[model samples]
Target: MDAEIGYLTPGRTRRRSIARTIFAGSIGNTVEWFDWTIYTVFAIYFSNQFFPSQDTTVALLATFSVFAIGFFMRPLGGWLIGTFSDRHGRRSALTLSILLMAVPSLVIALLPTYSQIGVFAPILLVLARMTQGLSVGGEYGAATTFLTESAPAKRRGFYGSFLFLSIALGLLIASGIAWVLTNNLNRTQMELFGWRIPFLIGGLASLIGLWLRRNVDETQAYKDMANKGEIPKRSLRWIWRHHRPAVLRLIGTSVLPAFSFYLFVSYLPIYAIQRGGATPEVAFRASTVSIAIFMCALPFFGRFSDRFGRKPQLIAFACAYLFFLYPVVNSVGSGFWSVLLVECFGLLAYGLYASIAPAMMAELFNTEVRAVGIGAFYNVVIALLGGTTPYLMAWLQSINLESWFLVYVCAGAAISLYSFIEMPETRGKTLD
Candidate 1:
């Protein structure tokens, strides 16, 4: 193998540069998730501010409907920006996507409330969400692909795992900020203005991410593709013709990670508040600690996968699915420490899947369709499974069938695990 061009190398200097690339890529993920989750964490307070209907559930539903709209735009964003990433360069695509996210997140942070502008408030909220959805839709696949492609082969799992460690950190940042702000304010102060603080904070984090991203180089794979004049004339078209199996496989494999990630990271706060009958402070604390524990372990699991192979890690995770998923979710409201323990356990098990799946899945497709094929399909599942998990859980809980939510997630995980068996083991394989 060519020492410099191959995924693995024995060079100390190259390892450090790979570290820098992963760090830069991880920041955008952090900022994107933080920007996204801040909206969810603060939804209870801000939903009424932007959308006031006679029934509170209806108003909250409308607010989350805007959230779902963001999800709807994600597939389109994934297809568009992902094609750009394939044709252009990964670093540039990532930088551009973060900027797209920053603008609307800042706008949402500072926008006027429904009380101030009537129906326009919700309209503007929907517009901002659409922008956010578009940004994230593009951000995930581009950023993760860059990080994975740039990392040293032996440590690809370790480095790639940071993508979600940073994501977990991002959620911790949102929940921590929301917890402090909500705790600081009198009820009126929080309702009036304090709720905006998290978005403001997200804008600042995004700006930092933008700055760091500026320093990273394009991936070698992309540079080679570009130099050969092999950038697909039609990235999307090539995806359908050549990579349909890879895409469908990703969609099924996506179900577990998407469901687990959203349930643990996105919806947990709401569940804690609404279903678990906990205060914001308690829920935020639980999420922070639980996710932090998981983040710490991400690199280890990822590095382990690099040695053991992708399929084995996913299979192992699947085998243990029954023991972890439902037990933890059902137990989250049991109390602070117990809920924390259970949620952290779930995240820990999820690490086996989330830590290595990005690189594993991306490697399955050819470079021509790599971007749109991976991004569009991967995000589409998230838009469905991840975006709707909470809403569906809420509905189930409303009907006194809350435990069934666990079964749904478990079933999804099982489907994903089954799909994993059919995937080729891509431990040290070359990416075309």
Candidate 2:
């Protein structure tokens, strides 16, 4: 571990360099999440274009089903890209992930509607989403590994928080675009063409992300591992044989965070409109404000973890979710201010987990298997739980059982709370 730490220079110059590197590393993540998120944000407008149904609910269910289908591809993405990141380098993996995301976004932007393409439209949409899912699965592992590895030892949590910060930025941008489009265009215009604009923007933005990631330095940890010939030949097999406990712990720790993230950040606005009786503009506006608050709070929470410990922050998040998620969900239709307040409150608590997740997860393994360890199991769990969140919520609402989804989220929180309790504190630890 000391040898690994030796690879990173500690100085003012290095500190200055770290900021640029973190931004460069995180920009691709922003684009990756932006591409991934716009699908959900615009689903209401575009659901009819691909899945024509007399019942809007059925069309949305179909749309969210495609969303869930895309998630099923995440594990495969995690495995393939995680292994690639382990073998090649984080920079290569990051670049590859962005390229994968860009093409799919462009494809979705350009594809014809069902009216023009018949049954092929939805099929094409599904294929595009699956490819983007793969990109995101890879993006999380690689970006987490890169950002955590690149930070100064004592400041890993503070730097690592940028991972989710970028995600929030992506969500903000997606929601902001959705708000602008919805406010500017009529229903027909949004359904016909406005929904495609975000995808086009995301696709073009990927070029900037690509160029940024391409120029950033590869992490010192990866460099040290390469110099020492520590790169694993088969990351997944090695992880199962040697580090099974760590991977399981990671999955457990992630359960609530993943579920809560989609529930609050991605699906909440939709819930407001469909279940809670809010308008699209109200939901989007509220969502945007809440997300901004969430994004702003991340760095402070992350820096706090650096001072305190990872476990306390994570435990706080789980307990907050377990106790408060029901009321938060119940507040969905209450009014604009109530919705905004709950969204901010819930996401602020969630910031406790989001801010330190990358560093904590990175501390679970050595550099060789770090990316893959997180990629393989983490992506699978997210696929099963996180990816299905919006679909499950929609399904529950359809049956007048939306409350059950709250129970489901709390159950996940309980599991995560237990996991956080059992896990050791990893603050100020050296990367191996």
Candidate 3:
């Protein structure tokens, strides 16, 4: 590992440079997440377009199954793109990931319905989602490494929080658009065409993200590794051989965050509409409000982690979910206010982990392997747990055994709490 340097020392790296880096890193992330979130948010409208099933639940199941299938490609994305980032540079990899996401999003926007093209419609949708899965799989690691490495050591937590801040922004934009479309268009109109608008918007916005990412400087950490000729042989076998424990630690730390994140941010709104008796508009409105609040709270928690410690906040998050998630989820009612309140509480707890997760995870590996290390294992966990959350919830709900899903989440929280307790504190730690 290269020794920590004064590359980001106060006088050397100006505030403006850091601000631009944060914006560049965050904007692309926002676009990536926007595309991902819109798929779920708009799935209800479009599920029948591709699946053509009589049973609404069956169509949704098929849609969400495709969602999980997309996740199957994430680990490969993480490995390939992560290695590319580690070898080429964060900026290049980020730009490539956005390009990957942009094309597939546009494809989804213009895709023909099952009635127009028969079984090919669903097949095309699956292929598009798989490609998007690849893009986002790579996006998280490269962007997280870029932001965390670019920040001053002491402020890594605060800066890292922007990742989820961007994510919240993306979710808010998606939910707001859904609200507008649902309000303005009739159900038939939405089912027929309105769902494609957000995908179209996502595809176009990605170009802006690409431009911003292309203009940003490569992270100094990567530059330093290059200058020192310390770039390691990029291989999954090598990473597994040397960084095995770190990989396991990351997976353990990620389980609860992965499950709870998808549960709160993506699936819960659907649950509210389907089971909690809230209307679609009410669910979207509540989601929009709660995400806005979650976005606002991320930086505060990030800053707090810098002051207190990452472990403390992460522990609190796990403990809260472990003990309170069942009750909180159960208490959700049909009202907009009830949904909003439950979402806000859950997301705030998640913010504690989201704020500093990038910094904490990046600190676990040396510069040579940081991006790939995180990309490989973190995404695998996300693919396995996070990507499956919505499907599992829907499946459980279908079986009238939804409460069992809560048990699964609590188990994940228990694992994460143990991981947090055992993991070393990373506050203010310089990245390897």
Candidate 4:
């Protein structure tokens, strides 16, 4: 670690600079996820606004289709922004991604409903989600790269956990907002206008995230690579040619976390409310508390990974999921308290994967093409799996095979378990 070449500061100044970088990077990442998770949180309420229908399930299906559409756009975002991050800089790429997200949130907040504009409402809503999907795709790569590269090798797991913690915080905030609106507004009022409030707030919050991200310093690893003129002529090409194994492994290992995250955390409220017959107020309230616990627990797992190792923690998560998936899904049928308990326990299992996964992925690639490598592989898997969890669950339920959804999640965890077994321990290892 060359202090002069890294933070462009030494001693206390460098430490302060690192802290600022973490805050700036993590906040923008949080906002990106906040914007994303809010769509799911409010979809049950706003489905009628965009796709008016007699059948509530039909309207929800349409809304979730658009949500999945946003995910399909992520790989493109990953390709564009990942290249930009590798070529230009992580700070610039991250700031641009946040800027892209802000516009969509604002549009969704103020856009006309189906009653006012007919089918164009859903069309525009889909367009907004497309833009957001792209933003989120790029945000992960830049944010993770920046966070991992900014920290000391020994503390990388601890620092990288903030990225996932931010995700939990984003979801927690979305759930809290949802709970507040549901508690205050009756169902009709929520359908009428209450759903727009969180989107408006998210849009405004994006501006603050953009401001914070603008001030973030470039990561030392990136700085060093740039100074040495090690940037690839085509970063993605380099990744494909030289790092295909790592990319494939990333896709494999990412399946469990991505699928489980979308299914367990993002889709929990919907599952609880729709299938379990829990009230929206009860569901959102439980989500808020459970996710808060998840967020707070992330740093502890990260620190633990720093002391122990990445593979073992991930292994623990996978084994837990493999064994508990059925029971967890079964318990949700018992009502709100049961759903709450399952979700809270699920978060602990998820923490093992979320808190340290970024550090492990970051360790797999050198700085020159790290962003592109991560963005492409991770986003593609998420696009194919994570983004479609809700839609898949809905379809499964429609077909009277909803139990298979749990089995599907378990299969992903099995794949991830094998990957974890194969993965080298990355704790205390310097970024390549």
Candidate 5:
């Protein structure tokens, strides 16, 4: 780590320069989500190709179970990489994680199917997912913190929304890739070779993202901390001792957004193709369209929070989301227009939470423990709410209680709503 640094007074950059930094921070996040969400979309096809076990459904369940494991590994990724980020620089951490994810995706793309390698294929699948998981786990904290810090104070909330917008873009790419492969390839082709295209695309994007990130400046906030040698060596301890309330607050606040986001992007396709009598191609098309709109809407809400404060935006979204959980989900069975109508509203509400989360979470702590505190808390909630949600929905479906599953999602939003109502706003406030 170089000790050389300089002072940066607030509000001192060209608009284009600031936009570049935000884009750089955002692209890597976009690539990460591309690879991550691609795994889920393609799993429907490749789970059978790679993991041919007793039952395809059961194998997919197990595969996704391991998929959830990747998320579980994220806290460690956050703690280790985040500590390095807090101690050294967020740029370094962000760069390393992007490359970490790229390599695994490429390798997984090239791996042989079950017929060629037997059980070793899925084992390799699990191993690759774990590696990607570790990278993404660290990537979120580092990148989110980087963008929040790099963003101008007046626009931090809106700029931090870049994190989710990029995530939505990544998901869009994943859906597009899946759609192309499924539509263009014959069943034989998809099962054998077509499935690799998305992973290859993801890996290549990650590399390009790595190059883009190199041009961005180290965050001025982290630079100042380094100049003074004031970074906490044990940020986890500080968070545990001084910031536990904030951590708990973040976990509760994170649940509704996390749940709804995953429900829309991660599980909805599964529901459509498997339960709603839609083809894979149809499901991907609907989801792709919905995500494109969601991505575009993020910046609007992101900027909205900056003007309106975080709490009210979150509260309004929470109430609307709880009301729509079951109705929107069930309405999707009606066909293209209906699915789009339902998902658009659902994802729009979700965008409110996702867009502001990175900035709001960063605000919960001073720069000292910002990374680890956000990482651990966010990962724990995602573990409970996001990682298990599809499985939970699947379980509910098995019990003939699909409507009851809506209750689970609505309940999560209510928890976050109450949490949001009480959580203080940090709009335009500087973190020291």
Candidate 6:
């Protein structure tokens, strides 16, 4: 561990740089999630454009399958770019991830429909989603490490909370936009042109993400390790030799958050429509409202974690889910209020886990391999569980066993609960 990792003399100039770094790091997170989620938000509309299926459920399953394909690319992205970040620099990796995301958004925006290009349309859509997946695979690890390392040691949890703050905001904004589009456009309009609007907006927004990230400074921790010539030549080998325990903890801790986030947050709108028989507008509106509350609640949990401890909050939340998830999930019915209430309750429960994760994950590995370790561990879990969750839930429901989906998510939470029980408290620990 390097002694010089978090040193900073108090000054206005330095404070401003920290603010800029936080903004630069977090804004791209917003864009990355926005671009990623817009596909899910609009999947009901756009699925028909690419997948020419007579069965509506088949078409949606096809679209989500493409969404899952993008997720499969995440591990590769995490490994390659995370290794590059370990070898090169976080700033470079961060910038490259945002740029990679922008191109896919633009491609989806301009993509020809199956009506025009037939078989080629779905292929191009899958390719674009795969690229976006690659970008996000690297983005979360780089941005989380950057934000956590950039903050003052005691407040790392508070600052790191912004990663999910941005994610919640992104999903909130996407839901809002989707709601507006659904309300204004009829089914025909939405299927034909409305879906493209959000993708184009996301593409244009990526340029701003590129600009902000370019201006922010790199972390002192990474620079200190690099300057001292302590960075290992083979980062994966270093992890295997020294931090394999952390890797297991990472997987154990990562599964529930990844799985539940997709199930409760990303999949909520669709769930409302399919299981609850709500309208598209109602579902999107419910998500927008619930996510707004979720976004507002995150920093409070984060700051609380900074004061109390991450492990306690994580365990408490997991226990809450273990006890309440089945009841709450079963209570959901075909109404706007039921869907909205369930979504809010679920996100609030999730905030307890999401708020503390960035700091906890950063604290697990030393600076030498933090980015790659986080990128690989986190993305692999997300690829396997998070990406497949929506499809899994949909399939379960189709098979007349949707209750199994609830059980699956609860099982994931239980896994995380056990991991958190065994994990050490990293509160007030300096990023070294």
Per-prediction RMSD in angstroms?
4.3, 4.8, 4.9, 4.2, 5.1, 4.9
Q: Estimate each model's TM-score.
A: 0.90, 0.90, 0.90, 0.89, 0.90, 0.89
Mind giving the per-residue lDDT tens digits that candidate 3 earns over 1-432? 233456556545677787898999899878988898899878999999999888998998799888878788888889889999999889999999999899999999999999999999999999999999999889888999999999988889999999989988887788678778989999999998899999999999998888888889898889988998756677989988998888888989999988877788667888788778999779867877888888999999989988888999999999999999899888888999999999987899999999999989998998888888998888888877877776677689899888788889899999999999999987877765
Compose the digit string of candidate 4's lDDT tens values, residues 1-432.
586556565666867877787788799877888899889878998998888889999999888888878889998898888889989998899899999999999999999988899988888999999999889999889888989988899988999999989887887777678768989999999878898999999999999999888877787778888898656667566677898888878988998988777666667777777778888768766766777888899889999999998888999999999998788767685366877887887887998889987798899988878887898889999888876776687788899788888888899989999998988787888886
Q: Cα miss at 261, model 5 (Å)?
A: 1.0
Candidate 4 pairs with clashing backbones? none
Q: Model 5: runs farther than 4 Å from truth?
A: 1-13, 112-120, 267-284, 327-333
Q: Is candidate 1 or candidate 5 better by lDDT?
A: 5
Strongest candidate by lDDT: 3
Q: Write model 1 residue lDDT over 1-432, tens digit each, in one string.
A: 575555455566676876788789888888898898878767878888888878878878888788888888998888888888887888888988999889888998889988888888888889889988989999887877788778766767777798888888887877677667867798788778887887887887788889989888888878877888656566556676777888778887888788786677656666667767778767767877878888889888998888888988888777667556665565667378766776777778888888987778767776666777778988888877777877788799889887788788889878988898988888876777
Clashing pairs in 2: none
Query: Which candidate, 3 or 4, has the higher lDDT?
Result: 3
Q: Candidate 2's C-alpha lDDT?
A: 0.87
Q: What order do you get sorting by lDDT, best first?
A: 3, 2, 6, 4, 5, 1
Off by over 4 Å in 3: 1-13, 52-60, 114-120, 267-284, 334-337
Better of 2 and 6 by lDDT: 2
Reference-based TM-score, model 4: 0.89
Residue 132 displacement (Å), model 2: 0.5
Instruction: Single out the weakest 10-residue window by summed lDDT for candidate 6.
Output: 1-10
Clashes of each: 0, 0, 0, 0, 0, 0
lDDT of 1 at 409: 81
Report the C-alpha lDDT of model 5 over 269-289, residue by residue, as the tens digit: 767766677776677677778
